[model samples]
Target: MSFHYETPLVDQSELAQARAVMGAGMARILGYFREDGARSIRAIEEAFTQGNAAAMVIPAHTLKGESLQFGARRLGGIAESIEQTARRCVEQRLAPSEVGGEVAMLRGCFNETLALLESAAPPSGTPRPPMPGLAGTRPVTFGTAPRTFGRRTG
Candidate 1:
């Protein structure tokens, strides 16, 4: 397999696979990736500040997996490097500062991934299908109270 360095910004094949599997839920899935990626970045920062090597591994690993899933090859590689470095620190074979540098690299890659994904995403006017369990429900308009199930509130 080619490394992230050689891979494109987004792997159409993986995205096609995701669309095939997720169907109408694909929109939400894409949203989740963006939200989660940002959250993972924060988590990594917190773990690094606290000197929690093991904790660092969790977010980096998560970011790596998510990036790969989204076809963000370079970002995935950077995250993977960070994850490995954090693992090494946890094993006492390396210093946390070593992982810190990798984190900086990851930040740059992450920003690129976000920009690519934003451009790839559907336009704002596109309508999203309701999620499962909320099917057939009407959306509450602005200035209107939310509807309750099986009862009405004054």
Candidate 2:
């Protein structure tokens, strides 16, 4: 079954709430989300490649929740589709190929979602005003160097 998102790709309200709750910690959390989402996407793609329907569940499920945490509805919806379809395929002894197309689309959705998220995220490695007690100490942000959002092969 195909999925369409009724909501925006990224929900600003959810992000705003997260930012309000987390304050400056939002950058670190976004960094964690970026890393974790990529790893989970890789796992899901690898499982699909290996024809392991069972292996697809965890990563897809992980991606679904984490995507929602960042207000990424489209990515979360695609991931949920993968997770549910893979689970059904496993139960029915169907090949992972049943869910192959969605699996193939997963990374693209993730990249799109990441682009939106990164746009909303504070710039990593950019200098910020020093904290009250720590003069001349630039706040450290966690994340890799900026990427072009291109899908990595291999």
TM-score per prediction, in order, is: 0.65, 0.72
Residue-level lDDT tens digits of model 2 in 72-113: 888888888889989998999877887777777777777887
Using TM-score as the measure, which candidate wins? Answer: 2
The whole-model C-alpha lDDT of candidate 2 against the native structure comes to 0.78
Q: For candidate 1, lDDT tens digit of each residue in 58-121?
A: 8889998988876777788778887887888889855577666666666666877777765665
TM-score of 1: 0.65
Local distance difference test, per candidate? 0.73, 0.78
Stretches of candidate 2 off by over 4 Å are 5-7, 122-154
Cα RMSD to the true fold for all candidates: 7.7, 11.8
